[model samples]
Target: MFKRLYCNNYRGLVNFEIELDELTLLLGRNGSGKTSVLDVMFALCRLLDGSAKVTDSSIFPERTLTRWQGRKEQTFELDVELDVEFDGSVQCVPFTYRLEVEHEEGGRKARINREILAANGQPLFRSDRGTVQLYRDDHSDGPMFLADWSASALARVQPGPDNRMLTRFADFMGRVIVCSLSPASFATEAAEESERLGRDATNFAAWYRHVLQENPGQVAELTSELRKVIVGLDQLSLVKAGLDVRALMVSFAEEGSKPYSLRLDEISDGQRALIALYALAKLTANQDCALFLDEPENCVALAEIQPWLMEIADSCGESLPQVVMCSHHPELIDYLGHENGILLSRGNGGVTRTSKLKDVSADGVLKLSELFACGWEQ
Candidate 1:
């Protein structure tokens, strides 16, 4: 699904690029900057959603930013270049944003240095001072600010002379779902949460119940898939997940329970993981989509991983939709047959260097555990 990824000046990543394939699995030890990779992908979606500022999308957050306050800091930059093909034609899209911070008479200030878009191999738009010129097919108008603008606003008033992959990728994210783990997906209604909780599942119970009543089919399908992921899991059920009495309430499977309150804490880690997996799997099973699971081993038990991976490979393996995950599971590597799908993280002095397993040598493949244990090297 994700053909390639390139990022610069983003936290642990300075300049990075790698080729990706369907079923790509990125493996690295903790702090190998694996989580950062997921962060960047989500940041990409946020940009397309117009919910995050370019600076906010950066790895260098304002609160944590500390770079010799007395001296000038080099500009922070983020660039995402992608190759996407749709309807039989491939297109190259690049999104680059640059910001410079300097002390002005003892006060720190930030200014944009480069904001440009290139299609194929040529520049479509460049912003010297926030002046953006998106191409003709672009639905964005003028100098857009994702931090403060809405999609409807951009679609209604964007300049028509510039184009960037973000233009289409932005549109794709609305329909594309990328999530880690939110409580509501498996929360019990009476337990104090709902389904489809906004991004974080802060109010999970109410949303879960409401959706079950509104779209019972979606919930039923999700439950069915979850049961498959969790071996020997039969009679799967959700507690206090939907709404009740025109007001929000949780539903439970207990005897004589009012089904008004459900808590995420009640579920096991394995169950919670399955909930996320199934929810996304259900999506791919229904639409032309791709699922990205970052470090799926988080809650999924090591024993169940192989069966689960095979399950995904068999069910969606042929067509319609697909699933690609980044994992560090050894059984997963062995089950997949070829280490070619594996992507190792390696670099010079840096803590991360991610590339496919197909590139690893005999030692690298034979002693995979040692390689993962070594973390990173020169």
Candidate 2:
């Protein structure tokens, strides 16, 4: 799981650093850079995946850079620490990835000036204008030149027995899940099935079907939990729709009554949102990774908020996935108390600042909800 992150000169953030817990909650007003933080993280994922293009798409090579507005030679950097299991043991690996880009003529394109990767404060690789070098095994092998420049050198390097640390980092990055779900999308049929839940939850029913096929007993557990909060949500099933269509349909029945079934769209938006989130939690319950959620409380009802929070917490287990959720919900803050709440604010000349509620609440007397409700920013 990701333990800490430091981002510099990225979008609305100038310099940001925060330590993440098992279930870290980003709480503050909107536009304080909460979504920007997650977007940057997602951009980093795309960068490492070698999927970003040069100045063509939303992720990279110039779209993700902080708008310089004609400022000279701005750079974007991130220092991330992850505790990952490798060779049957867990280790905390720190990676410092930086990119230097210069805007081309007319601001339509950005060219890479420099890109570097350092692990545990030791330089492992560097790329200058697309030419790359790998400092193998702590530089004992000197710098071996690699040919890739359009992608991250760290992702390009093939890890051997000597560079198992790099392999672990790659594996951890592959498992990172960033979800920003849309309930409407959940009803749509997927073009192709996914091994894991999609960020938008477009393949939710297909993924849930896969989950149930792998472990049939999980439905009983899911139904038990859903029934507790949803009153009549006794069972869930995936049924065929038309020729090749499949959908997640819920069954509702009270004691001594015939059960009724409804498709996802037939249900209220709040119910659909809750069901998708619950399915996501269950699908990722046993995985060890980082899950970044953008405003999970969207479309959820006020009465079901507490139960939904509890269900999400329980799905994360005692440790795993290191959930980082962005929300402005007071109930969520109140339920998380103080330790898990990381407050974000735009201060100090329009830079996004961060501080944990644990630090803001003196004497530990006020609940996090009350602290925010009482205008803690003032």
lDDT of 1 by residue, 1-378 (tens): 355566554555555555555566666655666566666666554544555444452422433222323333324334434455555787655544433332234333333444454444444444445444544434434353432211112222332224334455444443334445554343344443332333333344444454456556666666666555544444333433336322332233444543333234555766656555554555345444555566565667777676667667766545324455666666655555254354545466563566555555545345554455564321
Q: Compose the digit string of candidate 2's lDDT tens values, residues 1-378.
A: 566666655676666677777788987887788888787667666666555543545454444445654343446676667665556988777877777656665657666678777788887677887777766545444456745544566677787766665566666666677777777767544333455555666677777766677656556766776777677887787677667667678889988889898887788777878877666566556656578888787888888788777877775635345788987777887777476888889887677888777777455576666667777742
In model 2, where do residues sit more than 4 Å from their true spots?
Answer: 54-56, 61-69, 72-80, 83-90, 101-107, 111-113, 135-148, 158-162, 195-199, 206-220, 241-245, 312-319, 361-367
Candidate 2: clashing pairs of residues: none
Best by lDDT: 2
**Candidate 2, residue 120: how far the Cα is off, in Å:** 3.0
Cα lDDT over the full model 2: 0.69
